[model samples]
Target: MTDPGRPFPRHLRQALRTIAARVYLAVCAALLVWALVVTTTDSSDDSMAGVIPLLATAPVSLVLLVLPDHAAALVVAVVLGALVNAAVIGWCARALRR
Candidate 1:
């Protein structure tokens, strides 16, 4: 039988999970912004280093890892991630055609 005084582990686990989810969300947001910057910058420069794809996919991926049951978060992240990736690719392609 679980002891009445043994709530610490459960509380600790939840706290850790919440912190992880927040961190993942923050990172994803940053990556999305970085992808936009990469797209706008000069194509001749190597600042992006071909990481746009990874940035595009990181939102949903990291959110899922942090909050598996958060379907809403997953959907939002996926949609946003897709849009970010699309924007980056579109800009890059346009830069190339110039």
Candidate 2:
């Protein structure tokens, strides 16, 4: 069993508190909102409404293409991609802080 001291390491916590990390998170939040709006409002087959979010999300966003076509799946994919991006940003900020 692992020690139950801190749930997260010191550096990671610090990184998450940094300005760059916060900005990234904010941008991700906006993107998520945009994606949700596009997904829910645009029903046309050639809407092209998801392009911005999909491109902004990149590699993780690719999951949307492979998953079964459904609104829930799209939401899940975007949320997952945003989470992964937040983690990456936090790690990068932590590394650069050292």
Candidate 3:
């Protein structure tokens, strides 16, 4: 028989999962913001081309993690950012291909 005063086992598991998800999302947001700031502020000739996708994807991934309820917005952002990045890369590749 279950104890009258004790909570169900699944409740604790669910709560832990929620907390973990929030923490992961917050970390992703912080990383995205940091990378964005760095990329914008620094103007070295060394190509930062690689970091752009990381900047774009981090926020979207955070949204997916923390706000599963808002999956549409998150997914749209991811797709649009990816397409933009791809287009830019394709342009560069074509230019180099010539």
Which candidate number would show the highest lDDT if scored against the true structure?
Answer: 2
TM-score, candidate 3, is 0.35
* Span of ten consecutive residues with least summed lDDT in model 2: 1-10
Please report how far candidate 1 places residue 35 from its true position, in Å: 24
Clashes of 2: 0
Residue lDDT tens for model 2, 1-98? 32377455554566567677678667766877876787678777666656666666667978666889876666667767766676678778777777
Q: Could you give candidate 3's per-residue lDDT for residues 1-98 as a string of tens digits?
A: 43577666643333334433345445445654565566567788564533443455554434444445442544445444443444444445444556
TM-score of 2: 0.69
Clashes of each: 0, 0, 0
Model 3 spans with C-alpha error above 4 angstroms: 1-17, 45-98
- Model 1, span 1-98: residue lDDT tens: 43487675653344334433445446656765665566567576556522543444665445544545543544455546654444444445444556
- Candidate 1 C-alpha error for residue 21, in Å: 29
Please report how far candidate 1 places residue 53 from its true position, in Å: 12
- Overall local distance difference test of candidate 3: 0.47
Candidate 2 backbone collisions, by pair: none
Q: What RMSD value applies to candidate 3?
A: 17.3
